[model samples]
Target: MSFNNLMIYRHPCIVKYVSSWQKNCKFYLAVEEVTPLSHVLPLLNTLQICVGLHSILKALHFLHEKASVSHNNICISSIYVTRDGSWKLGGMEYLCRYEDLSSDFLNKSRMNRYFKAVDSNEEKVFVNPTARRDFIDVYAFGVLVYEVFKSRESFDEVPNLDVFCDYCRNELQHTDPSQRPILSSILKHDFFNHEFINIHSFLIELPLKSDEEKMLFFRSLVGRLKMFNEEVVASQLGNLLLSRMVLLNGVAQETIVPFLLTPKSDEQEQTDQLFSEDTFKKYISPKLLEIISVRDAQIRLLLLNNFSNFMYMFTKEELQMYFLPELLVGIKDTNDHLVSVTLRTLADLVPVLGAATVIGGKRAKLFNDGRPMAHSNKNLPKEGTPQENEHPVVRDQILNNSISSIIDSHNLILPERSRPDGEEVETSTEEIEQSVDEDLENWDDWDLNENHSILINRLGIADIIEDSNDIAENHSNEGIKSIVNTKGDLARSKKTIADIEELDIKSQVQNNENDSFDFFHDMEPVINSSSKFLINEDNKCDVSLGIDKEVSSKLALNVNDINEEGWGDGDWD
Candidate 1:
């Protein structure tokens, strides 16, 4: 019945349970069986020896201190080896509940002289279950710790090894169980302190025998990745252990990416810092490259989710050379899931690594599967029209458009911000957020290692699709003409339709209701015209539905010609 209660205990130091069955009246419990610890001792390395002693004592400590159970027989023979290259304490059937100081008839079962619990009243041949449980395990553990180091000839110079061994022997064999030292004290012994500062490297390297263990291993690794102070050890664990596990058996990208994006220490629920540099160099880069190489859509989606984080680590050339091709492929992909993920990643990257998305050393080509891919190094079109070669009026027109786009934060904003210098600054929501990486309340005053200028080169959605096919019909033809007449006109139109709408909403919030312009019906972008380039003054260039429209912009061209002598109202053809 106690063993049934004990079966619920889950820890790395305990044997794993799988299933149970009954035959006739007796029941059989099936569990994972492995090599005996007694056989693995001589072959153990320094790290392994430290971890093994820790694990064995850890199980005994948990059993006595946590579960209030006692292993009447505690020794090397009772300790089992697991397939994971670690040790576990088992033989639970010989376990007993911790009782108050009382009689014990355990001599028959306590045959291991090294581990036997003695009583002052030798004839009584009994021990107090409650008082004896923890101390008994602690004393036995001390002996085990001694045995672990006794095999090492190199430890000959370790001054206190023999003395520590003698101390453990005296403590374990002491007739007064109350006099024995506890597990923690033995762990702090000079023998262990000088040799093993940490046992994580040894235990962490052991193979995970099941999916559950693998999951736990990864979660633990990621959890520890935020230990910025212990970065070197953490890096080695992630790069070596994490890489090996992922290669041998893959992990769900969803499961791992979130951990990668937001790292935490043991104290905080949300953390702003991690050993990001080392993590990127060792863990993120290799894992990402390997995962991307697989070409799995779902896995790729997971990768896309974390691409924003990747921007800070990768240089512009690396992103352009490595990431852009696959992203282009994702954009043209027919699979809705892959396309969505790919587009999202690009959408995030454009604002931060905008230049990287431009067709660079390789050109985007229509590939098999009807997707676009980077084919070869070809000259991408140069930016802006050669205004130098155009007529004066055309040259001024290109300049005006260029200046307007730059002022709008690449056409991403609508509302104008008033600056203290009396200059109105209009920028995007992205621009405002980019200045400082504040996350509402949790974070403030910290800036990511990214610049806003990259976003300046980013063409909005309208720009990317403007030359595609029928997308031009949805836009103002006047704006379209300027975009068509000049190279990178589409790229120059920085704001997406959604961005404009958002800006519209924001501007409306700040303005009087009547101040709103009915753009679809009345508002039209005035063409840039000069005295020498004026068309016929008879016809006004109007897109309105035969109605007066609220002309909001100062840059709107006058339909009527203005002369130096006097102003005359006349339509332009």
Candidate 2:
């Protein structure tokens, strides 16, 4: 029979063989062995269901368009499972026209037997026998999805079956068969949404519940969904499970706000109460961070976008020390979405950590390595050059450490200036130059003093001239007259005379010009010593200068003593 050959070749799941073949027969009769629905249902999961449903929909579309055929028997029962678990629609007995059949007597008998209950009904149903059969098959498929959500026997005794059947009947009552809602609608019913509700609140309310129970429940749900549909499992089941775990871990306070603000009235309030920001920060952040470290770009992007919305929950210290490095690494990702999310998280964190610290530190590192800005300047190399191959991690650590040292030093020095009436005095260039010149003048006066005279001052004449000019320009007649009246000018003159004598002695002795120190080097010690005293207006400077003169006199005496006590071979102190 033509139908038998077509069914055998097209429906691989049909294993039974026809006993005899009749030529010129419009219909083929075949006995096919099929795996029972009970055995097959256990193997179906959300992924398999999705794949199977998609395949069937495509097949149905092809049949309707290309083959000019419609599967009137499209129920799960009519769909046979192969050894490898894939499904194919097997029973096609209802697809042929009356004229295509060889045995009209047998066909009538079958119609009478099958339509007897329908024929007995008094009310006229919108009955095209062909269309009715197809509608019935679609209605049965809807029931299959309903059964999946319920997770019960397909035809078990249940009080809810009557209500469900009534709903299906109402939905299938559309005048145009094609206008009925497709299988996708039936699969995604609001009731099913309620059934697949997030269980976060249950764990929270019952804190004493065993972790084993939670894990069992979670693993079971995820396993089932993963088997049936991986994307659905990832987005719906996996996310829900992660959300619950995150909530239970006390980090939900951060993440739960958006959901709470738009509470689903259909879901229980207790469930809604479980979500919070703290749960998100504590549980979700770490989990996502872990995922980001290991997972592929696609998965990492998915997790990152979901996690980034509540980045404000992380503290500045946490973000800088922990999250920022990971976020920075993500900038190299090829996925535009991931790069955008990583940058957005950084943007949100910048205000919290102080933009200067985060962005400035990044900029500093980029500049150090000669890399262009992450966002700007496309002509710049993305990767570092050989010379610039220094690791950012080590550099960042060193920079942070250096910053800490600076902060500590600042703190240590800040208290000294925190006087109640202390106004910050801004140092002017003129004041600094005046101070330097005063020190130089003091050194000159010290050189003229016999008691304070040294052997080697070697002061720069050019610097002395520069100092004299600076002093002349800054010091008014009134300031100099006041200084001279206080015995300050005499003391300054004495120091300058001592300094000049020391310079004369050094210049007279140094014959090796090429090996000799420069004028700045020779005079630097004297200038530094004098500058400290000149900078301050306190009496300590005068006292320090007197002590310096005394120390110089003592050093001269000690040198004489050593020379006089010499026993010719070695000097004895």
Candidate 3:
């Protein structure tokens, strides 16, 4: 059978089954062609190997706990590596048994006979078969891990697994499985200690190793484990990898050792153990401080992304005091995407830190530094003085818009105070009032008045005379001056008369305020009386503000339309 057919026929990790069905055969024979370990081992890294080993061990533990099935045939060759670098136990021919089965039976029949025997009597007489077998699998897995670490060399070629197995068999021959050292003990045994030669030196040198070496090592370890049983492979791999990483990083040993060695669990000692100056300098400080110095936006983003995960292994105070400055610098990035992500991270972290001090500090610095917003009026000459004639209104509006955009983009809503302890704390309402007052203090700084005036003029408000009487009064004064100077002309006189007539019309309209009010009140009746009336009224106006006569009449009719729809009768003010 092909690999595809095998995948379809059996478990995912196993190879294709190559056998034929035949009647009158004493027993069935199934042969599986597996991928060689040489082809698989080099693909895994230290981390991947560790994860695979961890998972395998856990799976074994689970099998023992739930199914009570011990897979006694545990070896590197018995484990198959999946294309995705996962390990699975296979090749069960070597499984051990307490009962001797007849040679005429197939491997399955022998397994069944062994399982029956173990289930019947051995479980009660000796340790539970499953648990005992799981440990055996674990032991085998450790050997596989050792094999991978030694680059697939035989146990005798590196450290003899036979010797270790013999030692285990001799020392842990008790009937009670509890008397045996578990997989962890096996891992930390003196035999393994010989394997970890110069552990302290190796760890200390890991940081200095090339990234390529780290990547290759990790890949090879994982790939090798996948060629074996993935579960056992992953568990052993994970533990060893984590152990190496901790040792290499010096984080756990440095932070955990001295305190654990000490007798008293003093508060100060505990605090010191949890946080230290060297801890900050080693992990948090360098990554954060390096962000500012690194010019690449992509690199900065990657750093920021990793910073969160790194900080997860530390406390809140460590993050804030050490890493926050680097995070803040990213927020000021010219790249919109970088700035957006940085701000998002800060927004998330604010609640975690529980204090506004860091954010507040950044906000203050941002405002003080005269950043992009300071150069908002790009139209103005860069070298020009304040008096050299830039429109203040335009400048002010731009500045306000920029500042508002920055603040809004960050979603920096101020915290509301209910008092954390539920006490009725007396805060000065005056401070709140003062904050509101400060909102417009920078209005003149950005030049918004000129912009507002330009908008008003563009809207034709300049042409709309405020009062006709005022126009009339100015025209009369001009005429009087012209006459007094003996410069009065026919054109001037005619212009003055026209101005007076327009003023008279305006004055009449202005003086009839009560009539206008009455007209508004009675508009519906007038409009309903005739369409001619509506058209005649509309034609009198120079410009329509888009209000149709019918709509206007309806609005007039419902002037006190508080009960109409959304308008409530409650005091709005």
Candidate 4:
């Protein structure tokens, strides 16, 4: 019967009866947790007392005026305060529906021991069976107010509660139930007219209000929201603003959500923030995230547009897990504005999400992939320690060695070429001179007398002089004059060859003076020098022959030719 009455006669000011069950033959009634007003009475100030008393009056009014039932047990013990500090009436065991007096209902009786208030037969409001049932609750309501204020040392302790004190003294506690004020009349007193109390009452009845009324209320509420206590906004107004039953329009929601986010304005120094840090984390942050997660793009945009205001309130883990994933949805949204804002918001989030997760591939290896560090053979080998023998050989050495081999084989005196700058190539010159000296020293030991005739025949030099002698005898002056000019041309050719410093393989030294003796330069220096001596000694002819001067001159010119052959022509052939 008690559960039925609670469930049936529901009001915001009445205790909410949730569910009931039987387990192991034990009956369980599940309801919201609450603290009785009696438990928190000492803690109540003037404003708290007024708000609590106001909530109870509304509950009693619901019973008497609306439901036509009587809460025969209205008292401080029966009033329960929820977590948000809103007061609710809970003691319904003694409630009676006078209009429904079936036999089964009539058998229900009120237990006298539990009735906190003393009753008398003289008072019709309490005992007269035929009396108005509402009068009983109204009188009990008065007693509840009196007991609350009377608990204080003096009425002066509470300032604005004078109206409540006066009403409790004269009207509600009146002996005649007809003279006592109605619940609606008592609610109009100054004590119940506080901003916090009115806001609370409006939220309690918010569900039944028209959308237009709610919009006006919420729009007007924007400025007035900060006037209420933070605890009230956090607990009551937050849930009420978001309640689906309220059917709040988008504008109404948009208006209220910011107030919930920053419950206190910048003007208040008493507390710069109304809700504590914990309140923002456990309460405000989750609410903002929930609003962001909603599919309504406008609502998501609203939260995202003001994300900075709420983002810091969320912890790091919540930002990554809840906030980032929801934001990614906006990035993928078809709305261009939403996607743009989402990308911009993500750019701002880089510091929080980090470059690895945002710009770079997060799971990618930043450096080496832990494979053994080894050089690949695909590329040319890197420059290593330079080789010791890497320096190039001098050109002089190769040229000089080749000339030396030909000189040794042909038994000749080859001319030594100079450097490119017309300076002598000192190394090659020294090597050639050393080889010539060795050959000359070897020749000095030879038997010149025995080998002289054989050497002349072998060289074919005798044939060359015989031809020159024959030509001189036939045209002596012309031959002698042509040879003089030819000798000059030969000397000029050698000087020009040295100036150019080039090796020419087919160099032919042509002398009009003596072409026959040109091959004389091909013989070794020792052989050429000794040719005249050998001929002068071995032949023993010609002091008066008149061709001796020409013969001697021819031999001298032949030795010069042999010397020029070694170096003037570079040909190995």
Candidate 5:
């Protein structure tokens, strides 16, 4: 009968009954674990006692008035404390209905055990057990109060002793069974009245309220939740709030989350905060992880917006393994605002996820014609290998080729590929000549070799060079008359064979006309040690003639000395 009563009843102050069955001819009962009240009695202060006693009275009222069932076994040992510090009524072995209470049942089971032993003088006349059956439990509650107070030395030891004594004397301990107060009247006493107790009652009835009522209640409850400084109380409160997160509106949620997570306003009162650090780690953090795993955009966005308030509650490993992956889901969402917010959240996580994981990840390769090619070291010169200096002839040839290409590029008409059709481009000869001459002026910085065969071929310089030679010939004819006046002075001046060899020699040709032109006539005549080359009236040599001093004294060399040197080797050939 007791097991049936426990299994049938459901109340916050009652021990939560899980399931019961009989297997192998044995009875099994499962219930939520709770601590015996006697074990933690030493730890309770005045406030905790008020909170606990209120819970027990509510349980008695539930059994007596609502169910018309009498517990018949209310004692120190029957009361238990849950993890959240709320007291519960358990030991229901003597449970019976009010209609079933008779003298035989009271004498056999309830009237003898778990309370103070009755004295022989106190055993007076037996009264009608059914007339005042509820008074029996009320009288037992008076005895419970006497026993609890007797354990303390003075009123100062338990500050609310005067209140409990007044209630016991005024109602529960009345000699006439008719005069004793009922469980409902006993519950209204000042001993069970407190702010925390009222909050506990409100929470117990919260689920039955409408959404608008709950919203108003939660909004007002935020400021008062801080009064519960005990870890057990705060943890239970947090559990209640989390369980009802789906029911809460946005305004209520926003109002309560900061109170649960943010630190206390006063630093000195940190230890007295309702949601202490330990409570968060043990309960709130794991609950938050489960909450974030849900993909509802509203919940996700709310957590993200207020992430800074509670982010410290999670460890690095927890964020990395769980929270980080969940947060990244927002980035892939189709909503532009969600994606934008997710990007900002990821930026804040850079320190934890590292630069390479969050914002530093690799991007796709770019395909562009203008992209520069990567550098290569394949053509770099090797160490210890003798570096050959560039020969002036080859260097000059390369330079002239480059300059000639530039001039050609600037003067050439549009190619057929660039035009709409393969049509020939018409350009004036003067335009081509003018462009080449402008480019040649830029090369005056370097003392280049007079021979420009490579440059002439690349630039198509046949026409331009021919024109230049014609101009040079005209200038030379006029210069000869002036040179005749200085010829007498030049006849006495001696020169070496090297001076003649150093003179510049230039050749020119006309395009499409195959006519060769030379600048020999324009050059000044150079004399050697041999007097045969002197300009005189009797020996009037052609000013455009060539001279070769093949056997001069300075040019003569011994064949033996040449052979003695390595030049005689066949490798030189």
Candidate 6:
């Protein structure tokens, strides 16, 4: 191997190093024994994919940033999944620091099929040899991501491919190195989404440097408390984070409400293990009230986004107490995004309220016509943690678009009752739909240039792109492809590299930037409630309950039918 020092390091993803000795002219490399990643193709699951990808990303990050080296070859054969299902990135034989190698050397060293990355300028792929080859890791990371998601029985079958961004099923083959988002950004991306895979663990911090560092540091503090301050740790975290989110006891607990977030109970689990009832009541609830009290559009939107996580964690009382009132308030907000997130959140909330009505006496009374008008906004110290908005910008973006907004599968209209003086009533479902259609028509007419390219407007109606998240190159990318039907537009398929090619690989989204939303279909009725439902064309992960008239019209899907699983457990990547 070129870099013998590779034997010295240790990382969870990297194979553990053991001592090696040379006998005669022959040299021996003793290391932990593990099967090749290629050896375990059939055994891999979405959870293993997340665990492995994250481990590889972290391993690459450590190698590139800390050690100033990049694994020249990051491929299936080189990597290995641990017995516990965690991935271990190996292939130290190809390790190369930022050396000023000649083009010939680079060419010989890299496997043009996957390792070689084309530069943005599109001259020669390996033009500069002196600069850090960090982007290669990014490109490789993208390729590996494709391979992991698009599995195969053997290495030959693992074809190069693209991923489905909320916008399109685009190629991961980015020709440019700089265009590839960095390791830090990649970690936070919704693409490597722990939620989607139901991995139940995600420790990726925000994409912003300051925010990422702040979160990582606070996480370190939490870790130290467990390591050294075991006695006072639990309460200490409560005092510090103002919530017991630290003592995450798989809040994907035995809890149920009117609606379910996931279709299957066993397949569902809470990864983020956040916003437990007590956590919300003591820490998150107060902050939300602060935001609701002030009513700043941007801040309120951000706060709502941040606070929206509580909905998944809400019980009947918690939903009626915190999420329902605040989210309904947000529905009245002028901003499209705010209304979008609030409404989708409301879609998730109503079932819980209904469940309360189904199971409890009049706990749903909180949701009556005389309910509160709208959600407000508040200002917390920007330097606070997730418990206190330490990195508000990243926190807000992640919470709003990715967490709250993107999953906006439905909306409802609060029908108005007749006044004793015979005053006018609230807007009917038809009228509200008409008004929404008119606004959409006006907005689309202005932005849409029909018969040209597809319109790329920020028209949100569902979850954040996700309130979401990434590119790559080299090798044959032909074969069966999976397509996510987002807006039911063929134009999307055409516009994207949905049909693959070598060049013009657009960058994959690593955040909820410039993402759009589509309108959902309405529901009839269920549970004697006036709330109608809207179902996003794409996300059918939750119950799509809706009918008409009485009983049968009552389209109340069980709250996730069985408590839908939660999000990332905040475990570090």
Candidate-wise lDDT, in order? 0.50, 0.41, 0.40, 0.56, 0.57, 0.42
What tens-digit string does per-residue lDDT give for candidate 3 at 1-573?
A: 123233333432344466645578654545544455546668755544443444344445444454444445444555565433455555544333323221222234446332311222223434343334444444345445555566633344324445654655544443444455665455455444432222322332456767565555443332333333333332232223333343233343333323211222234442322223434333333334534355666545554544443445446776676567667787776789998888877876776785465566333333465455542434432211111222456434333443233233212322232321212134323343243334323323223445543322211111122233233232332222222222123112222111212232333444565573442433222212111211223222222222233224433445565454553468475
Error of 1 at 283 (Å): 16
lDDT of 1 by residue, 275-313 (tens): 446445554565455556557676567667767766556
Kindly report which residue stretches of model 6 are placed more than 4 angstroms away from their true locations once superposed.
111-132, 152-172, 193-573
**Candidate 3 Cα outliers beyond 4 Å, as residue runs:** 1-38, 42-59, 65-68, 77-188, 191-573
Q: Tens digit of lDDT per residue, candidate 5, span 374-409?
A: 422233222111112334553344344444453444
User: Which portions of model 2 show Cα errors greater than 4 Å?
Assistant: 1-36, 97-136, 143-169, 173-573
Ranking by lDDT: 5, 4, 1, 6, 2, 3
CA shift of 474, model 1, Å? 59
Q: Which residue pairs in candidate 4 have backbone atoms (N, alpha carbon, C) closer than 3 angstroms, thus clashing?
A: 414-566, 414-567, 415-566, 415-567, 483-513, 521-561, 521-562, 522-562
Indicate the worst ten consecutive residues by lDDT in candidate 4. Answer: 495-504
Q: Give lDDT: candidate 6, residue 548.
A: 18
Q: TM-score for each prediction?
A: 0.37, 0.24, 0.23, 0.53, 0.53, 0.32
Q: Which stretches of candidate 5 lie over 4 Å from their true place?
A: 23-25, 110-112, 117-130, 145-161, 208-219, 227-236, 241-251, 263-276, 282-308, 316-573
Write the residue-wise lDDT of candidate 2 on 275-370 in tens digits.
Answer: 344444544445444454553664455445555455565566766776777778888877788888888877777677777866664444444557
Clash count list over all predictions = 10, 41, 39, 8, 0, 55
**Cα-based lDDT at residue 570, candidate 1:** 59
